[model samples]
Target: MPVIAVLALDGVPGHELTGPGMCFGTAARHHPHVAYELRYCTAPGFRGTGSPAPFRIDTPWGLEGLADADTVLLPGHAGFRDEPEPEVADALRAAADRGSRIGAFGTGTFTLAATGLLDRCRAATGRQYAAELARRHPRVEVDPEGAVVDADPFHSAAGVLGGLDLCLHLITLDHGVPVAIETERQVFMQLHAPAGAEDATGPAIRHGTGPHSLGPTIRWMEAHLDHPLTLNDIADHAGLTVRGLNRRFRAETGLSPLQYLLRARVQAAQRLLERGDEPVERIATRTGLGTPANLRHHFQHHTGTGPRIYRTAFRSMVAALTWADGKHAEPAEPDGPAGADTDPGPSGSADDRRAARRRT
Candidate 1:
């Protein structure tokens, strides 16, 4: 099991701490073997205050808790524009030197940046603060629109919601997409809905009326992901020319038609890989990537791993989750080539796809 230490700074956003806690806690409940031991630690002489509200937080551990952590998370706070305490900065540097992965959410990136560990690395913070982050730390490449930036052991997210994205990304890395998706649904979905109600509508379904509406066309594209599609095909279905489609797509979704198609295909493939037992080649065929080679190429390009590795990790996580529920099953070992693909982070649909496209 991995150990995660969340730094509890004064004025930390309540959601930043609770959001990751919810995600990691949910994963532990469903998959004990891959669970993480989460700790909340404060710097020496710590005086804690809540964010987006006024409250108090009392943590049990001090700076020493970061010594043996597998990962250290820094959450946003009202004082993000200010430098962290010297002791906090030193402790973070030591943790990074020891090779513990570090993650920052919202304004937390500022604290991490203050440590000088993020120099020459890509990172992100809320769009409103992105310019300021860049102005303050020119060595760090700041992305204004990215939801998440994974610079290996150092990761950062753009907003409060991006905190959940960062946590889900970490879960996906520790376990796999299956566990991450389950945890995500648990965190984001309504709990009181009827059993079958959730599965009845796919993510693409939207209820609205407008001239800039691409809802019907998006739903069509999602439903037909298994078919080989072209920009012209999408334009034709949407009753517009290719150029007109491109304008509408960029205006409404901030993605080109082809980019949108590719994302939809990748998302569909991920679902198939996570929930089914099909071979990579079959999944590729089903998702209209044409061949396993094509799937591997695109999957690695989009997710940073190959299809077989994704299947193994996802299936193993599913098995672990099921096992925790007392179901008897053996997980398939990850036997493919060493390099397997995983999602870049929390991304889906038009808005998420746009953010991902910008990161690439």
Candidate 2:
């Protein structure tokens, strides 16, 4: 089994620590063949207590624990904005030199950025912090819209639940899709399943004072997914000019208003596909994608899979996992429907599609 070193710095968020442990631990229990030996390591001279509460973390591992790790995960800490300790940077650099995969969870990307490993590489942090990350580290290409970014040896995940996505991605790479999908279903209850996993929930709505908060506008957009909404309509509803809305949306959500609306439509389609047996043309009209061909094009472009295949594959997996006999079984292979290509298209990885959207 590969040894995974999870480094928890002072003021580490309690959830990030337990989240990965739960994910990897559940995978081990459910599929022993894909097991990983997980160890919690701390920075040198670090206090055992963490911020946001008064709880102590006692771990037997230290910086030295990363020496032989097959992978090292850095979760967010309260002081992530501050430059990492020189010793921590040196140890991380040394670990990278040893060919261990280094991943930054949420704001921990700051610490990885400090080590210069992520410089010139693409990284995804929380959308709220994407602008700041780009500003702070001009050399690192910050992907604001990506749920998770896999730049080979350097990986990063966006937002609070993004760590779960990163863990699933790692599992997908190590084992395969079936194990990762089962691990997600058994572990996280499918709450934050990797990007392609369909759900009713869309991207989080930002809440704040002044122009930054797009809660009302986002809700309006969601409510009007079936209607053809233009940029001016959205900007008018938000009481902002087109340029201002675009700028603010980019700053707050890391996506332009239209891009956000496009994602909302696609996500709405996902929910419909997952819940019903509607025809592709009817679903397209309902989601305002206009036509079936357009829906197929955009859905494939954004999600890396067509609607028919996604629905088939997702339902098959759900059925496989929900066996009545209380026995685990491999997911059923999705029989590709006519006109629905099983190929994910030329967009490459999900990360690449997200990057393409970011560029747009």
Best by lDDT: 2
Stretches > 4 Å off in candidate 1: 190-360
Give candidate 1's error at residue 44 in angstroms.
Answer: 3.3
The C-alpha local distance difference test score for the whole of candidate 2 amounts to 0.72
* Per-residue lDDT over 1-360 for candidate 2, one digit per residue giving the tens place of the 0 to 100 score: 799999989877676788798888777765434568999999976775453443788888999999999999998877777899998999899999999999897678989998899989999876546666777888999986535788889888753442766887788778876566556544533543666764323334333445447777877898899998999999999999999999888887778888888887886787677657899999999999999999999899876789999877766654443231112111112442333222211212333322432332
Model 1 vs. true fold: TM: 0.56
Best by TM-score: 1
Cα RMSD, model 2: 21.0
Q: TM per model?
A: 0.56, 0.55
Task: Report every candidate's CA lDDT.
Answer: 0.70, 0.72
lDDT of 2 at 308: 100
Cα lDDT of model 1 by residue, 1-360, tens digit: 688999978777665677777778767654434568899897765566564545667777899999999999998776777788899999999999999999997778999999999999999876546666787899999986546788989988754442777887787777776667656544443222357654211323222236658878886887898887889899999999999999988876667878778876876787676556789889888888889888888888776667778667654543443233222111112452233221123223323422452453
Q: How many backbone clashes does candidate 1 have?
A: 4
